[model samples]
Target: MNKIERIRELVEELNKAAIAYYKYDSPIMTDKQYDDLYDELTSLEKETGYILTGSPTQKVQGDVVDNLEKVDHKYPMLSSNKTKDLDVVRIFISDKDAIQSWKLDGLTVVVEYRNGELYKAVTRGNGTVGEDVTHTFKHCVNLPVRLRKPVDITFRGECVIPWDTFERINFELLEPYSHPRNLAAGTLRQLDANIAIERKLEYYVFDIVDGFDSGNLIGDYAYASDLDMPVVEHCAVRDLGEDFNKFNPENFRLPVDGLIYRYDDTEYGKTLGTTSHHPLNMLALKWQDQLYETTLTDIEWNTSKTGLINPVAIFEPVDLDGAITTRATLHNVSYIEDLELGIGDSIMVYRANMVIPKVHENLTKSNTWELPDKCPCCGGEVKIHNENGSKTLHCCNDGCQAKLLSRLTHYVSKNALNIDGFSEATIEKFMELGWLSSLSDIYTLQDHKNEMKVLDGFGNKSTEKLLTAIEKSKTTTLGRYLYGLSIPLIGRTASKSIGKYFKGDYSKFIEALENAFDFSQLEDFGDTMNMNIHRWYVKYSNVEDAYIPKLLEFDTPKFDSIVDNSSDLSGKVFVVTGSLEHYSNREDLVAVIESLGGKVSGSVSAKTSYLINNDSLSNSSKNKKAKEMDVPIIMEKEFLHLIGN
Candidate 1:
């Protein structure tokens, strides 16, 4: 292709990849491939002195929407220049003292503090302007609302969701987020601050945009640290090789796209001029991906409990990041269309973040492909539904076996029934053996104890343990039973809300359902959720052979006695971290706090009244945030004393 044509093609490809990665949270191309093409385009722009308006080399910004107010940034958030070449990195540093940190793969946000309180939080949009997200960011996991020093300053950082929170949220979502970055971005832009808070988004300050100056970058970081600001992990590196070896992204809990290197001398670094797209003070280094060629065997459609059918690509086994990889997720119909994927086509695959196998490219673009018209598990009618400009396949049959199996699996999950020994695989085996069909069938497993004992991977002791667990589960609380029902959009938290609202009386819940009571009036409850509960009870209860009533007979539900709401800790939020000395465990401490009319949150925020940690002086993120917010940290004994225990 000619130079101009190549430039156009590169821009189109890179823009598409960026859209997928940033907007959709789904990536069609590997990071290495995109960087290589972007570098080539940069080289062309430099040689010909002709930059296309759409070229990614000029400027790349997040999507601008009308939902949030737009504000101009005091300092333009310029993109960092990146290189995978070690030689280039060496040349840039040139024996100068530098700080190296992870380039967290998430939304870049700038938070301004005025009079020791958070004034504004804005996204990095188009370098010059940004969307105001202060309201939502107030609930960010480690974001301190009040600083120790009454300083007027603006600092830049990345907002992200940790992998654990991402995974837990995805488990309850019908269409899971492709990456934590997208989840964090979507959460930050949410209209409801409660939703953002539930996702547990975190912010790590990286650079002082227009804040208190100490003449040196490291000195500024130390100042910020004294204020207990949550900062990105960084180290002074004299040798690149030693530092790079020590800095492994795999060991980090957060998602990191690359490594960032910045000069420690702030004034000296500022003397170096900047390009239109990037600053000379800092550079990013992305990992080179190792792609493996493989052949597509077939596409498998797995129908989830929500009826959404997901496509999994089965391919010839290839070693990737020390594991044998054979399958990768094709996010949606649009993804398949973009790749033009087909059975028997030559494809390239790679591992993302040294984990999670992904398809990079389809070398053989055989456009001939067919989507299954029937559900693979139950041969039910399949249909396509479009929402938010995305097309997704779904199974029309609600009673499909695949959906039932998924629901059954969730019903017995740890957060639900707390049923031990009955895993999804074991449930599948029981279903295949005709010993299980519905949720009620689980209670009757004792009848098939003999048959199960002789089955594969099961013996007398295993069967006895399973039956004992089932018997013990009959004493579950109302929240567990409600969560176990698998009501649409009703998760553990919502179930707890319902259980507490009705005071854990199954009869009261039934009365509310029969009377068509407005559940939306409750905090955090919506019309859809209310409708879902009503519809579910009506559908299942009217049947003569209903499982709800039968299951209720087995459960001995319990509720907490109403506590005086005038307690000192009432309505206060507490964050518990580290080991406890006075209590048996964290859960015991949380139970006590809840009984005293106080709330327990997984993350620390400005709303928190206290942080309960035995190690009050520990430098954990929660402890740091508590210290920054001026929230008192109390040991277990101190907490108990405050509660008058």
Candidate 2:
């Protein structure tokens, strides 16, 4: 294809992607893939000077949704010139002191504050025009409703849902969001402010567009901070390469796509002028998703407890983000068909958010891969289920052995019964041997002690160890046992909430069930959750020899004393990062905090009372965020002292 022809194709493709991302809240491609194509189009446009009518290079991306009121931006909110190379950043800085901050991956909003109160908030719909989202923006948790000095101001910041909130929301969603950015955008664009409040959206001011006159980026941050507003974490950097090398996105609990470098002198930056699409004074250093090409070896379909047969792609093992990853979830049947995946086809994979391994693209689309006709575990008939345009495979047989195996596995999981030596593999082995089927069968394992001792990889000592662990697990709390039951819509947190209501008394919980209690009345419980509980009870109670809780002893539950003013840690929120020396693990530390009436959040925010990290001076993301929010960073000893340990 010639340059002009390629430009038209690129323009159409990129435009479609933008619509899918901004309008539909769905992404057709990864950010890195989009950036690469955009760069190619940019180079083509520059070389030929033949930019198409609707080329992405000619305008800012995103569209103002139909329901929102379109308002022209007071000043153009242009995109920034971006690069994936460190050399480009080095050139951009060129011995000038730069203010570096995270380029947060979320929807950008231009908020205006007048007479010390928030007047309006608008999205960066296009460079010149935007949708007014003031209603939803008012619900942002960290938004400064009333400025300290009652000064008229306009600032630009990101409206984001923290990674933890995103994951929690996604867990309950059938068609989960692709990323936090999508969720944030959807939440803010909603006409109802209640949606934004429930999602717990946050705002971090990055730039003072008007009202506040700060000489540099640092002063701008200080001005925003003085108003009790959360600001983006930043630092003065002389060496771009050093800071970039030290940056690790994984350390941050919030979603950040890259880093930004802005000239410290606001006046000097304005003097540099602007391009049609980007400002010359500010540059973005995008962290490209590193893709590894690997050949697909096989596809595995695993039967979930819900009888949903989820597809997992097994590829030639490749190292991604310092880990050897061989498998990535295909998500559903639609994803498989979309990629036209096939065994032996070359595929590109990357670590999403620097954590979950994901298949980015299929280089060789053979389209030979076929859906499984039978369930892998029980050889039962499988059916394809289409829900809300997404297709998934499910086992038709209700009594599939895989389902029972999954339930038993959950029962013995660490957060459930805390039973050691009963790995999923071991549980499956026992099920095949006709020694395990239901949760109650676990208590009867001692009856086959002799047989277990002689089994492969099992000796007299190992048998005794497993038996002892099983006996110890019998003394677990009601919350753990409830979670182990694997009821629909009842997660660990919900189970704990229910358990707390009954004061950890199994008899009291059973009484509530018998009396047809309205579980929705409980905190955080909804009609769906309440209905799920009743439905699960009806089915489980009818099962012959269903899990007998009487066989186990329930310990008294420890409720968090959040409202108790006596405890020093009460009402305090802590975020733990890095390695633990005083505690066994991060979970253990979190437990201690909870027991002392404190809450532990996954990310640092304005609400966080303290950030616990041994390396206080470390450049970890959590430390930077805490410093930015002015939250106290405490050593383990300091934390212990604060709690009067």
Candidate 3:
């Protein structure tokens, strides 16, 4: 084979190996085999100057834009004709070799390439027009920024977030997104490309609109995949049911709604034409939800960190997908009313996307469920909160055990008090035993050493360690103590700034509060933050049992005072953006920079000594601005090295 033909073959083999390994967790090539082929491809491309758009060596570029602009598509982005019946799919592909693949559940995107480089990407807004999302599209890790051969081409694909990625993101969030598709769509439309990069969106090319004429749908997919562009997993099949059974959601990575079947012959499909709504060439087989009927046993009211009481429906256990589920969140009071749930009422339940258990329909509709007038955790008065036409229950009592649990959890966290072995569960158990009521009670836990040692999950040694950690926490920095107090608008960064301004002396901080000193004088402390600080201080100080800093000793570190401008970073201005590895967030990094007597700016300018972004190659607005002004752009590790870290 010629060099160009060999390059195409090598690209196809390498991409197939990558898909098998990364997507399926099944490796078809040995590590050495993959590497050797990759090296050979790299050398061949360098020698011939013939790089395919989907080459593995290509660096994907990303850009940040201010907003999404509307664009007209060269081809109308029509949907596929859909049905829930297998018979309909069979009829569509009767006696003809057809291509079948997963009907992916994600944001449909049309990507266009000009001169072998990605030029534009747009969402399927309507049939003829779409919102340009090229900025975020470029951030997609699996998306090819350039295709082999310098030619204009258009392809359609679905930009999807993997189930694991979705779960991981939602796990860290208080109010999680309901579905992966929703998160994917939101991430793709984000004005900042970094959001898409952070989410790690993947695009799988399913159809080609121009440039390549493969004569068949499967041929098109093969050609696209060989070009190094990710293609949807497909197979040539004459029977829909025979191939349908092969798909198991348990083994799949991407969220799929159902299966899609299309005519193999492209020319023959064109003869069938299209409807006003969708193309007749392809038929989408949507999965019918499997539901189980069960009795509604009870409704559990769970209080959140913010004192909101959420309702959870408890029903007779029913097997959904593969797991037995007995409970599902009712969301709020409005949802319960909408479902008209009642004890012992019959209801139908199913897993949405075969993942989240949901109540499909309430058959009985008894409407006997009543709202609780008291808090489930503290027996305190409850009030209905009407937010955006939806009614939610909130615990009115400030000292509700559930609310106290949240505060205590944060108080003993590593970033706050650095208390060891004080898990939220342990704290709750201690609170339940009437050993803890306020922040001061934490120090008093030593009084219950004998009792605590005898408790379950706590031996004499474990109890002693907890007491030691608590005692050691009493000599922490003033910044930590302030953050532990959970003051409104006073986070770790703000608290640290305040602590530094006062020389890490608790007395000076208290004196400033007493004299009504304006907190907005501090860096990054706005008028709203100042108001929140004063309001929180006034309310907290008025409480008779508030946390007393006199019980603890504040650290006076040598570098505690920001007034001393002797650091190497002094007189320098840095602009930090994107995600961080060493620091928790941008605010954390900013605090360190400020502590070293350096200034931080929101934008890159002539005064910017350096722009700190982990993704140095990113074409984000900040990076672009820094380049235009000749400002040095450094990665997190390089910046750390500069500061002697």
Candidate 4:
């Protein structure tokens, strides 16, 4: 096909893939293949000067960014709450020292107001940056579209798709979105803002990011209650002190995943910094969905790696966690036959992480079960393998689909390829498209550019981006790729150690592995791990033979940017005590110290840099700590200047 024709075809495929994967959770391409194909299509389009109308390359999933300019928020509303049950939330609230409340089910947005005029509105996209939805915001029902009174203000709020109206919608023109969150996200990004107006989305204001008088405002959250504007509810706590009423009139509306807690005093807020993922102020209470028991009637054997035979229980339908339970994965064949479980045995099952249930025991042991003599998937004859004299059934067929899925999962996990934008949906898509089987197929996606565009969400541009991402990934740290290869027990830390020893030279490592050299000779190499790695390389020789060449062809990632010292304030602790200025934000300052491996203290002690005062010099516990410890007090600017990032 000509380049233009090829580009057009690929875009169509990508569109289909996007729809199926995003909307249906059924996908047809692996992220790796998709990335490669996407890259090729983009190159083709650029070469042919032909971008299709239905191209994902031209748009971001049927939505286009607005023309409005971005305005920096004087205050950033870090995201909050991610739970569904009120019982757990109630328990958390009962235990918390203090709490605030608001609607949990709304699209969070930041609104900019200058001199009391509504100027702009932005939707929270990825927590850091947001989409400009000013025009759509004007059409939203709850927002006045114009201010009721004149005041210089820049505030944040949430716009939600209410459950009632959300359920009522049954339009022929609308997409059959599975949830309100999806519908709301799609609506806010509509090309015609008027279409968003038809959706009945509403807004509720909360934090004030910036305004003319914002600088002079005290940190009293209750004062916002009297400002004649909708404010999100939250209470400050001196401690998880004397458990206070966290739930008030303001608490019920939000559809929350969990509750949020912040130090009430601005001075206290400053002392607490952030972790890599969360701020020190908040503690998230995840609702644990545990497993419950049901009667087990039958057992099914599943063969896995290391030839361990697993027994699954067929049980009476019962509810455990959220979903109804019908089966539990029996860890081993011995586990099943050992239970003496029969056709009418009562059994117990439980779920952890709400993912899987385990068949613990048969309450009523009716009779024993027999082991299957044949492989379930391929009908291959099964053999009894004696592991340390304990017998387990093994299927000679090593290419079972279920087993492959589990193996592939390990290959693409966080420790492995570390391929960004790869989701389980994408993996299924790649397998369905017949573009992959073994790991090496990951390197050959560029040849299938024409097929990828036909899938949903892949356009010439997107495909190009994916391919770019893949190619960029070709040079990741050697440890990541090695870990990704599913080399048995070669964990991420071990792989890093090996990669550093070889300086990311996979060929040398592969060669050394092939020879079965004495690993005791290698420094810091454990005998068990060395033997394990060597055994893995030998057993998967065919795979290793193919993989090493691919590695040799790609660029290697380095560990050169290592920072070993937090020398600036090492052994000394620091607490943030008040509102920060001069530093870009709390995250930036914390990140700087953390990058150097320095520790940040949540509570004050003897070792502290000086409690930072954001509250125009307030006396707080952190301040007292600084005084008692003879720590030097500093401001945000001074810290920033000291660090000199």
Candidate 5:
């Protein structure tokens, strides 16, 4: 193809990929392939002296939508000039100290604090106008709703969902998010604050836009830290050569696109000025991905507890990032269709952010691969589910072995039944030996003890420990038992909320479930979650061999120590901040508050009855909110005294 034609084609392809990656939370192409194509487009544009108006290279800001109210930013939200070359970074930081931090791959938000309370949060739309997402951000983990100083300050930060939270959330969804950045963006723009809260979005302050007088970036970070602000992980680097390699994005728990280096001297950075697109003071360095070619051997479909079938690509082993890798996730049917994958096809793969193994390209376009029509584990009818324009495979059978195994594994997990010595692998082995087939089988493991001890990896000592742990687990509380059931949309938090709502009475919880009661009336319970809970109970409650009846035979002591329905603090919201002296830690204090029928919220708001801070006079955001809202600011000792402790 001619240069102009190829450039146009590349532009179209890159724009589609960007839209999929940023707007839809689904990536059709790998980062290496995109970068390679981008480089080719840049070269061709330079050679032809022609650039398309809609070229992806020319875009400075992300996609903007009308889902939320738009407001013009006081300071233009500029992008950072980026390069893959460390030499450019060295030149950019010449003789001055620089602050290097991860360029978090998430939505950029400008949060404004007025009179010590969060006034607004807006996205970076077209660098000038942005969407208002304050309501959604109010539930963001670690984000302060009130400032200690009551200062009117606007700061810039990245709203992100951590990798762990992203994985867990995606694990339950039929159409999983392709990347954390897109998920974070979508979650932040959600009209419902409860959705954002459930997803557990977090904000990390990276820059002070309108508050600080410090001429140094490090000083600004220190000032922000003093206000108990969640700041991005960063370090002062005097030598780029010595420290650049150490600031690897892979080490960060949050998803990061690259590393950012900016001159610490604020005045000098200002003197460098900025372009319409990017500031001259800051430079972003993206890692050059190393792609490896491998032969796809087969596709493995694994069924999850939600019945969603996930595709795993098994390929010839290849060393990647010092580990011998033989497989990578295909994500879903759409991903396979996009790649036109087939067995024995030569495909290119790379480790995303030097961590996740991903298929980048298909060198041989042999589109012979077909999705399984039957469930791989149970040979049941497999159905295709279309959700939000994404296709996913689901096992239609309720008795699918894989689903049962997953549910059983979840039931015995640390956050659920707290059963020790029972790994998923061991459970699978037990299932193979006919020792386990359902959740109730876990309690009756002793019946097969003599046989289990003779199996591989199981001996007298190990079997004894396993049996002891299982016996001990029989004394779990209602919250843990509910969590162990693997109810859809019912995680630890929801289980605890439900447990507390019913005062940890299993019979009351069962009665509510049977009566089809409106569980949304409970705090933090949404319609979808309530529906999931009722559906689960209705499906299994009547079964003669249901796990619930089997589990009820065990001891379930009342959770009286954790909650008291008659306390004066009942239904009141308290925000605890800073160090605590009356309690062992924040968790201990939170437990006490929850037990007293009080709710502990992360952020202070108008509904907050009190702000619990040892230093009540301190200028923290929670204290500021209390002062502004005329809420009581009480010390730990005073709070204890009020509770008659």
Candidate 6:
């Protein structure tokens, strides 16, 4: 093919390659080849002004993602111009004054507050359309669901879970998370609103997305922290004329694909006109880092407990993003076959999202291919498991290395049954030395005295400590036991309720839970939770087979007070209108109110609660809700008084 055909072919190929790389995690092109083809295409477009119908040059803006609804912003979300040279940043800023701030970690969210209460929270989907996630934001107690005053404003902020929280949760479990950002993102997408509330997700309001300003005010963008608005951090700076050094974009929290430079004067912002796709005044600077290439040594298939096999490319370790990366996830079996990838093949790699180093392009001047016929760890026969056109390779071995300790830990996690002392590190090390095999074998520790001592680090004390910890944990709390059981769809809270409905007896719990399956028998369980309970209970058969007997000793805490199976707030919704006197914060109050079977309202409507209004008289809207619905008007203290603390 000639140059035009070649360019067209390459662009289509690269776009497919990008979709696999970004959208599907099945990368075909190496970074160098993608950059080369992209750069070549750019040069061709610039040289002849012949832009291909679908050239990457025009679409090199952001990663294509899923689980996100494309929502347009009131203001268009634009891509940034990137550079690695700090000197260039200094020059860019020196031309005008600027400020540097610690980039916060988490998800980018747009929240709208109406009449002082939070109206809605949305994800930054495509900078246009976004996913509505007010429910997922239940964890953000720091941000009052209803504001203290009537303020019709749209605020832009990041939804972040602390790195410390992420690490702490993963400390004992095997397969600790790679980063906190992905976890936060996944957590925010959970279907359960109650789960989000329990996750402790925080939102820091940054830019006022929409509000009537007295005048153009950028510096006038007041810090909420100064107002003691439950804020944790803030910063302020002004740009100096072209004399200072360039800024480093890497310094901020929460990973930034780029940075935004806006006029301190909102009026100056209004003055700067817009381009077809971007604003002329507000510039988003992207990061440009150098990349490298390498030859793949091995295609290691790592299977997760969820049964997805991820292809890990083991290559010669080379530095990228300030660290040597020898292994990068090939994503899935389709990724393996799509690239026609094989051992000893040349490929290019680069940091995508500034964190995960991904394979970008393939370099092939000759024909050479190698595919594994057997599992690497157990030498078991492997086969591709496919569903709805998606594929993954699985080791037929029930006891494969991929099913090692980390998998076991996740299987029994608090989400599973929450067995204590079965952390990922300890389990993996035990398995690596051939000390443990199955989940049930974890309870049979004392029988292996000879084997435990033979292991390098193991002595008498460590062995006994493990055994003693296990022994002491016989009577686990209902929630922990249920979550730790590794039952499908049965989380900690769900497990506890199941346990309680059965009077803390394991046998009764198993019988009722299994009977609840079959769909027709399930009235107490919600429709969405139907399949989960069915899959878990049906894993085995017979009343005895379903119940794990003498599995361990355990005890549960009993509630001293009465629990109303029929809730007072069963269908009634409530919105806390002001600062609560009896409850220290909205969260404590929301929890108690919700536990009583009440649905909390975010905005005032015909359906509302006492408003729990401390300033209910001063607040016209709260009063309006009471009048419109003829709802009872009660004070926070009065509500607590009726509850009789």
lDDT of 4 by residue, 1-645 (tens): 346546755786676655543433333433323444566776787887877655655544321132333233334445332343445355544543444434344466777766566776776543444556777777777665345557666776777676556666644436454445556656776668878878887666544555433221234343343444555555544444333345532344433333454434334444666533244544444333334667766777765533345677788988653446687656455456667778777776665312335565678877666778787765776787654434567766555544554555566565465555656677668867777665556667778777776779787876776666565556455566777765655666567667655554566676787677665455445666688877766566554343132333334443222232223555555566565554333433454454444566544556555566665356775676567777778776666555552
- Tell me the alpha-carbon RMSD of every candidate: 15.0, 17.9, 17.9, 18.3, 15.4, 14.5
Q: After aligning candidate 2 to the native by TM-score, how far in Å is the CA of 636 from where it should be?
A: 69
lDDT value, residue 258 of candidate 3: 76
Error of 5 at 456 (Å): 6.2
lDDT (Cα atoms) of all candidates against the true structure: 0.78, 0.80, 0.76, 0.56, 0.79, 0.57
* Residue 351, model 1, lDDT: 77
Give the per-residue lDDT of model 5 (tens digit) for 1-645: 367767966886777777665555556666655667787898899999988766766765355564565566778888787778788888888888899999898889999888878888988866777778999998988976577687888889999999989889989999776668878988888898899989999999999999676889999999888887899999988777667777766667898878899999989989989866678889888778888999999999999987899999999998775447788888788779889999999999986533347788999979999989899989999999864555789998877778888988888787677678889999888888776766777777899889888988889999999998887666556677788888877877788787767755678887887788898887657777888888887777566554233444444433323332455778798887788664444644675578567887656677788888899889876677789889999898888777765
Per-residue lDDT of 550 in model 5: 42
Better of 3 and 5 by lDDT: 5
Model 5 regions lying over 4 Å from their true place: 1-214, 217-259, 263-284, 446-464, 520-526, 544-563, 568-645
Better of 2 and 5 by TM-score: 5
Clashing pairs in 3: 52-148, 53-146, 53-147, 53-148
Winner on lDDT (1 vs 3): 1
Best by lDDT: 2
Task: Please give the lDDT score at residue 330 for candidate 6.
Answer: 75
Candidate 1 per-residue lDDT over residues 1-645, each given as its tens digit:
357656766776787777666555566666676778789998998888878765787776344443565566778888899999888888888889989999998889999999888988988866777778888998987866689899888889999999889889989988777678778888888999999878898989899888688988788888888777889999987668777888898788998989999999999889997877788999998987888899998988899976789998899998775557788888777678889998999999987543356687999999677988899888989998864445789987766778878888888787677778889999889888877666778888899989988998999999999998787666555667788878877877678777667655678888888798999887557677899888787766655553123444443444332333344567898878887555434544665577567888655667889888889779987788888889999888787668664
TM per prediction: 0.51, 0.50, 0.47, 0.45, 0.51, 0.47
The alpha-carbon deviation from the true structure for residue 29 of candidate 5, after best TM-score superposition, in angstroms, is 15
Q: In model 2, where is the ten-residue run with the lowest total lDDT?
A: 556-565
Better of 2 and 3 by lDDT: 2
- Mind giving the per-residue lDDT tens digits that candidate 6 earns over 454-564? 666767877777676555445344445555555544554465455444434556555665566343233234444557666555643323431132233323322112133
